[model samples]
Target: MATLDLTQENFESTVLENDFVIVDFWAPWCGPCRAFAPIYDQVSENHLDIIFAKVNTEAEQAIAGSFQIRSIPTLMVFREKVIIYSQPGSLPASALEDLIVKVRELDMAQVHKEIAEEQAGHA
Candidate 1:
């Protein structure tokens, strides 16, 4: 299946509804983003069980800005509506697959609780 195109309009519904989502924040003019497109597409095609969505930084500035994407081709992995991995580089196909595997194995409840405790401590 083709990767889903996420916009500021549908971003919330799509990402929040899916149990596992991998979103790529990219721009058409970015060289690295251009290079990473095919790799991400292949992953999307190979992994039908997960949702792959693209956020165009230029078009959906508000959504991209909220995510604080300083670089193009930033990838964010979300499981059960909580962010698990936020990496700011283009990863090769193998590395992307490995990341997916690791995320699938994550103990999300514990991870989220730890993040909450860290946030509370900082406050």
Candidate 2:
């Protein structure tokens, strides 16, 4: 439907609900972040099933730091609460749409399970 503003309060529940998510880590003061807002919104409008979230780095500093977001407009793709893809800077509208499509096609369940097992082994 639309992009959700993710804060520390809701990040855990919303992002870790065993679903796919595309989080845009941004700050209001960043020029590239502003430029990417509409493109990100366009992605949400087109991909109804995907959860599009926005996190204001200025406000969610802890969350941003946890993700090691060094850039203003970083896009992180997650599946089952595990990060799959992360990149800095802004993307074009068409590229954004392609990313959504790619994410939808991935075998995320298997991936997440594998990741979980790997982490468990390490732990």
Candidate 3:
């Protein structure tokens, strides 16, 4: 699947509707972002079931700000409408593939249970 162009207009709907989404926050002006674009696109092509998306920081400032993106080339992976991974940096193809595998293997029920327990403890 090709990467979707993400914007504030469709951000909520996309995130709410997709079971799995991987968003790349980037801008053309950033050297690292440019270098990572192809890698991200290649990874997207291999994962047809996942929604691979891109948020052009230069264009979608609001959406980028909403996510508190402090750096370009940040990758965020969402599964079951929940964020499973979010971090700044460009990952190599192997690392990206490893991340996808880990995300797929995650037990959401256990993750949610852990989140709930942590929240309950805080409260």
Candidate 4:
């Protein structure tokens, strides 16, 4: 599937409704972000089950700030409405593909249990 251009209006719903989502936080003027776009797009095409979305940091400053995105080309992966991976920098196609594999292999029940335990501990 083609990548989706995310805005404040649809971002929350997209992440919440999708089982797996990969968000690329980027800006047009950043060289690395420009360089990573095609790589992200290529990877997106190969993963039809995952939602590949892009948030333009320049245009969506509120969303970017909420995530504390200090750099362009920040990649975030959300699984079952929980953020599983977030990092800065542009990844090569192979690394991105590997990340997808890892995310897919994750046992979400375990992850949710951990999250609940952590929340309980905090409480």
Candidate 5:
């Protein structure tokens, strides 16, 4: 799948509707973001099951602010409507591929249980 451009209007709906999503928060002026673009696109082509999306921070300030994106080229992975992983930095193709494998292998039932327990504790 090709990477989809995410905006403030569609970000929430996309996350809610997609089972697995990878979001790349980036800015046009960021050198690292430019370098990572092709790598992200390449990986997206191989993962037809995942929704690979990008948020141009310069254009989508609200979306970036909501996610507390402190740096460009931040990669966030969401599964079952829960954010599973979020990190700042550009990754090599091999590392990105490995991350996708790990995300796919995650036991979401267990993850949800953990989240529920954590929320309960907080409450």
Candidate 6:
């Protein structure tokens, strides 16, 4: 699957509705972002089951601000409508592939339980 462009208007439908989503926040001016783009696209092609989306920080400032993206090339993974992983960097292709595997293998039932427990504790 090709990488979809994510924006403020479609953020909910694109990321939240999907079971597994990988959102890449980046700006065109950033060298690292450019370097990572092809790797991201290649990975997207390999995983047709996953939604690989990109948010152009320059054009989608509101979306970037909502995520509090302070750095370029921030990668966020969402599963079951919950954010499971968020990091700032241009991951090597190998690392990115590894991340996808880990995300796919996650025990979402346990993750949700842990999240609920943490929220309850906070309350």
RMSD of each: 1.6, 1.6, 1.2, 0.5, 0.7, 0.9
TM-score of each: 0.91, 0.89, 0.94, 0.99, 0.98, 0.96
lDDT of each model, Cα atoms only?
Answer: 0.92, 0.88, 0.94, 0.97, 0.96, 0.93
Span of ten consecutive residues with least summed lDDT in model 1? 8-17
- For residues 36-106, could you state the per-residue lDDT of candidate 1 as single tens digits? 99999998888899999999999999998898999888999999888888989899999999999999999
Ranking by TM-score: 4, 5, 6, 3, 1, 2
* Steric clash count of candidate 1: 0
By TM-score, how accurate is candidate 1? 0.91
Cα lDDT of candidate 2 equals: 0.88
Residue pairs with backbone atoms closer than 3 Å in model 5 (clashes): none
lDDT of 3 by residue, 1-123 (tens): 789999888988999999899999999899999999999999888999999999999999998898999998999999888899999999999999999999999999999899899999999
Could you tell me which residue pairs clash in candidate 3? none
RMSD of 1: 1.6
Better of 2 and 5 by TM-score: 5
User: Scored by Cα lDDT, where does model 5 land?
Assistant: 0.96
Q: Candidate 6 lDDT, tens digit per residue, 1-123?
A: 889998878999987678999999999899999999999999888899999999999999999998999998999999999998999999988899999999999999999999999999999
lDDT of 5 by residue, 1-123 (tens): 789999878999999999999999999999999999999999999999999999999999999998999988999999999999999999999999999999999999999999999999999
Worst 10 residues of 4 by lDDT: 42-51
- Name the regions of candidate 3 deviating beyond 4 angstroms: none
Where does candidate 2 clash, by residue pair? none
TM-score of 6: 0.96
Q: After superposing candidate 2, which stretches have Cα over 4 Å from the reference?
A: 120-123
Output the number of the TM-score-best candidate: 4
